[model samples]
Target: MMEPIPGESKKRVRAKPATKREMSQFHTDEYVDFLHRITPENAHQFSKEQSKYNVGDDCPIFDGLFEYCSISAGGSMEGAARLSRDKCDIAVNWAGGLHHAKKAEASGFCYVNDIVLGILELLRYHQRVLYIDIDVHHGDGVEEAFYTTDRVMTASFHKYGEFFPGTGEVRDNGIGKGKGYAVNVPLRDGITDENYRSIFQPVMTRIIDFYQPGAIVLQCGADSLSGDRLGSFNLSMRGHAACVQFIKSFNLPLLLLGGGGYTVKSVSRTWAYETGLAAGVELRGGKLLLAVWPKLTIGHAQ
Candidate 1:
């Protein structure tokens, strides 16, 4: 397959690590300090702290733990900043979709909720921001963060029953001002591309029409694709990229983020292909990339 050259089509920029003040925007002070102070060398010392912050099994106390969290959150916030300043039409941060982190605790291998931080940054300039998650597991932390506000709307398509961090039910729409703002499409095992798009297109069309968001944050998790070690969906690479194509057709300020994907090879290929789609590069040489997916043109935002 012919691949697009990175420099010709897209530019890569290094993101500065997020500062304590910046991460404190969503995380509590105690939690942030706990993350900063604890390391693998001294993990046993902070037994109470570990349990308090849910950092044991999936989220272990490792070396450079705080640095990793800062970098991830920083990249996502920088992307949001670029969109807010009109510096780029679309920004892709593959390291910043750790959506399972909470204000005071970590879950599902995520120690910082970078998706929430990115949305918070976009909310500074945008009247409304729409977050779309295509990960196999529900984006529980992100939805909970914005569950009380209408400034951001979260739509997640994921496997629901007995899944890890199980939360995104169809009925669990947002509360108070955010009512009907949170959209969750619970799927079963082995959902195909056609079936996924059939629901994705119309639902997103209505969402864009009604919400008219100024910017969009899309979590393009590769685990939704077939052959994921931890996922049950049967979506192929083409099927997954189709979501990105449809969203890009809207022509809004877009921030693309990476989420959960256990299969390394599939994850790499999927992210690279989705990155090509975001950069408007036609990846040739595969029947999958041969225009089987339609280029949709939904109505412009008002």
Candidate 2:
């Protein structure tokens, strides 16, 4: 089970659900309407239509589906708002990062494209934003959303070829004025920490040097960790946290979001570790110190 940040205050940052108008900023009206119309009772009736939006099996329709999407998008928008107002140097919405949702259709277990919504929010205050995806799968929806814009640069590192969505290519740079703004580093299975860092560090440094973005959005998907159900990489908890450490070094207004992690245990551990890192807390070996729950103890199994 995941625990709360150790030193975090009791004051909660409330986020309002994104209205249809707000969601329509980056999504199509028809698509937004379809999401609203979905309900558990009527889900079966609309199976044919749901399939049109890629909402089946992988993207199943359940109770409160619309509300879930709205809340997820709301968390991302809240993070963006906090960054824009300078309330915090780094805001994290671990609930967001549904990066594969398209403008008019859902795909790859994503529905609202909250990353796009968050980036749009950030663009209001910053002239340029940098989006970095470390998920096991390509961030196809986000890349497509800003493919023609130069204001936001998207970079993704994921498994390519014959994969689920199969979109991101090494040469699929941005189009028109947005050329060279999109960067893709497609990887194969069983990628270890050293190899991943060898490529990640240099590529990210180069993008930072060239883009000079005012703000940054990072998707820390834990599926790339070893022993994941749907991922193929061999990253460990420490290795995954190192990526967060490197990005935090930039010291820009940053929004951290969650993405495609399927293994429950690994995802919880990875996010908790990253959260501790973001909160500037050093987690040493032994029992954890949590304020929210006293019964929980964190340590290595003997």
Q: Best candidate, TM-score-wise?
A: 1
* Tens digit of per-residue lDDT, candidate 1, span 1-302: 12223344345657777888899999999999999999889888999999989999999888889998998998899888877887678888888799899999999999999999999999999999999999999998999999999999999999969999889999999999999999999999999999999999999999999999999999998899898999999999999999999999998999999999999999988887887777666676752342322221111100
Instruction: Quote each prediction's TM-score.
Output: 0.92, 0.91
lDDT of 2 by residue, 1-302 (tens): 23333344312355777888899998999889989998878887787788788888788888888888888898888778877986667777777889999998989889999999999999999999999999999999999999999999999999977887798899999999889999999999999999999999999999999999999999998888988999999999888889998998888887888998999988988888786666665566844544331111111110
**Residue 91's C-alpha lDDT in candidate 1?**
82
Lowest lDDT 10-residue stretch of candidate 2: 293-302
Whole-model Cα lDDT of every candidate shown, in order: 0.87, 0.84
Query: Model 2 clash tally?
Result: 0
User: In model 1, which regions exceed 4 Å deviation?
Assistant: 1-9, 286-302
What's the distance in Å from true for residue 20, model 1?
Answer: 1.2
Number of the top lDDT candidate: 1
